[model samples]
Target chain A: MSSKKIKAQMRVFQELENQLLIQADKLGVKDDYNPIKIKEMEYDALKNHLLSFYSERSNIEYEMQVLGTDKKEVLIKLEKLEIYIKRAERLLDMYKKYFGKVFKTQNEEKEKIEKFLTKSRISVSVGEN
Target chain B: MAYEAPTIAANLSQDKMFSAQKAAYQKLKEEVPKEKQNEGTQQMSSLVWETVEGKDGSKTYKVGMQDTVYLAAASSALAEDEVESLSKNNNLRFRDKTLQVLKNKMVKLAMDTFSHNFFVAELSKMGVGVITFQMGLLGISPAEIEKLMSKAREEKNIAVKNGLAQVASEKALFGIVTGAKIV
Candidate 1:
């Protein structure tokens, strides 16, 4: 993964995360809505993917503890976990803190997530494939 | 050395989502108990008062409060001064700032991995060092990348060589909030 390629993949991860945020916003139907708790589900799936990539457990475990198993608590957990993100420059692993977590959507759920994402505010570039 | 292709372990599961929240709700329900349930779960409202100045003269912003779950998601990124404002409260505002920063950081990393562009003026000066902190924050092993690079060199594939070289840039890898080119 040469530092360069890792860097490249890192960029991709950020883009994907942005796409997911917009998706979450739509799935829940309001920027501040919480009845569905879709955001944590989003982070959860993304985290699972990254954890599998390296077979690591500590950070994710740490997050689960902070976020608890509940959706409401997950929002609070987000704040605590975020402090760690501040040090990302020194801990490249920090990116995983944000990027990991597979939002846990599939079947009808996948359609829903996709719909939200599709309807999300997307800035399109023209004349380029 | 062993070679392990990147694999996604699972997809998002609705059962997982509902169960987690249900569990929390159940716990809260338990706190009420059978006899006192109705009285216990009743919403208890708290109000905070503040004075405000309107065009006429002086007015007030009630600054009412909820159970903290109701506010609109804080803007996903704020300047240092804004961060300071959030901090002035009893950490409630700070938590929002943290969440927003967390959100922005998440997007920034994915963007860097996909785009690999130097156009982001914020992190470029940071160079390859961005890889460690950004990747580490995600809990992904920066070491994994390092190992892959080492393996690539030993194998000496021209394609691999080129890819590895591109990753070594020292850009910040992410920022407080990814804005347009940081200009």
Candidate 2:
């Protein structure tokens, strides 16, 4: 990981450490026990919290590893999609060329005029019916 | 019939109260799991400590607060182990780890108490002679105090392997040489 990533990780750990210290403070000295004695219990709870917190962080790291692999797979899939898109674009260009050729044909204008006349006649027939 | 209804309600209430008490007692009696104990030991093993070899070939591991807290939790349940591997060696390891933790804690406490701004101002009022005399009485030199401050800042996790001479003497002055296990 980069230094920036490591620094971000350190900041997260520091935040967790601070939160744990707060929790430890809330576990004020047990009146029944002396300072050292209460501090001992507080220490145990803090340790457990720290252990579990680190455990969660490790789990997150594993997840990040898994996600990283997923990213590579996604990138490969994206490359494949881009290839498919390029092929489709080529097909579209071919269709456009074919349509352009057909439109430029000598009979093309007559064909469209005839079709329009036929459609108009059909509409007139329908009106009559 | 009326008496029977009231008796059943009373019995149910009593049962509920009894179970609540039992649960509270069980919570109090709960022991640290063997798995957690093993995990704690595994964690402690990973920490780097400056090992000091004693005169009698004993070893004391000096470590910072993080290691100390970890080892303290691990060693809390060290005594009741039925496992063969958790023998005298493990106990001694735990003891030494705890002692190192205590030593560091004492060092910090001494620094905070003696070197606070308010305390320094008050000490100055007494005169420079009193300040020198106090250091002499405490048997801790100004250099050692400065070293402790520097080490505390620079070291996140460190141990002075064979660094017992100064620590032992300081412990004597601090009068808290006992191990973590006793505390």
CAPRI class assigned to model 1: incorrect
- Candidate 1 lDDT by residue in tens digits, B21-107: 456555655754653546556565543311122223332222222223222223323446644444454435433444544344433
**Consecutive 10-residue window with the lowest summed lDDT within model 1 chain B:** B2-11
Clash pairs, model 2 backbone: none
Q: How many backbone collisions does model 2 have?
A: 0
Q: For candidate 2, lDDT tens digit of each residue in B142-170?
A: 45544543454233112221122232232
Q: Write model 2 residue lDDT over A13-32, tens digit each, in one string.
A: 44543433332232221132
Q: Give candidate 2 misplaced runs (Cα > 4 Å).
A: A1-73, A76-129, B1-98, B106-145, B156-183
lDDT of 1 by residue, A44-113 (tens): 3334433442333345556568766546665565564454244332244443443343343335688888
Error of 2 at B156 (Å): 6.5
Model 1 lDDT, residue B178, Cα: 30
Candidate 1 wrongly placed segments (more than 4 Å): A1-129, B1-22, B29-102, B105-183
